[model samples]
Target: MLYGSTYPRDIFAELNRLQRELEQSFDIEPSIRGIGRGGFPALNVGSTPQSVELYAFAPGLDPAKIEVNLERGVLTIAGERTDQPGTPAQQATVHLNERFHGRFKRVVSLPDDVDPDGVSAVYQNGVLHISVRRQQAAQPRRIDVH
Candidate 1:
C-alpha cells in the first residue's frame, strides 16, 4: 500500500461510476446489451424500412415461459430462468457460477409510426425474436410528377 497511488481495480470501478453519471446527466438510456448493469438476455435491436427487429439471446430457456407484449409504442419482454441442479447440495462443491438464473425483464421504446397490431414474436434456438411492422403511411412510396 502506498500513498497517492490507486489500484487497478479501484481505477476501473471509478471509471464505470463516472460513465453511469455521464449517461444520467445526458438522459441516455442504458442499453439492455451493456455490462455493469447486468441486463439479462442481452438484446440486439435493428430496424428496416418495413419493420423493427429485436433479438434476445437467452439460452437454456423454455420458449413457452417467455412473455412478449407491445402497447402504446412500447415493447416488453419478461421471463424467468429456474436454478440449475449445481446448487450447493450435500455433496456438491460449487466453485464458479456465472450463469443468470432468475426473473428478468426488458423494455424498449418504439417509433410512433409502428403498427401495434402488426407485431409478432417467435423463440427458436434459445433466441427470442420480435418484429414490429411500420404503419403503411410511414413507409416510403414512389411518386411520379410531370
Candidate 2:
C-alpha cells in the first residue's frame, strides 16, 4: 500500500505496507531501526508524565566511537563497529557472516513537547539509554476548587 500495488507482488512493497501498519499500531516513529529502512543499530522510544526515554541497542561497539546529537527535536545516533581479529591471523574465513559492522546513522523525530535542555544519554551493556524530560508546561495538572 505504501509503494506498490496490491497485485504487484514486490517484496519491498509488502514490507513497506507491513511496516506502516506496525508503526501506526505501535505509535512508532518511522524508520526507527533495522536494515529494512536503513542499516545497523535499533532503538525504542517511550514516554511518561515527566519524560521521554530512548533505548538504542548497539552491541560490539566502542562507546567512545558512538555519537548522539539532537537538533530541532530530531535525534541522530552514529557509530562504527569494529570486527574482531582472527586467532592465528589467517584462519577466519568461509561459511556465514551475520553480524553487521562499519558505520551507521539513524535519525529519530521526537515529540514537540520534549525539553531538549534536559536530555541525557549513557551507553551501558550495549544499550544507549537516553532520557529527555517533557516540557513542564505540556504536562497535565489537576485543579481543585472549594
Best by lDDT: 1
Q: Can you write out model 2's per-residue Cα lDDT over 1-146, one digit (the tens) per residue?
A: 24333354467645755664575467555464443442357678799988989888888789999988888999888877765677322375434333555556788788998888998999999899999888877457788877
TM-score for all predictions?
A: 0.66, 0.66
Per-candidate Cα lDDT values, in order, are 0.74, 0.72
Off by over 4 Å in 2: 1-38, 87-90, 138-146
Q: State the lDDT of candidate 1 residue by residue for 35-127, as single tens digits.
A: 334366788889998999998999988888998989899898887777767566335754533466666678889998899999999889988
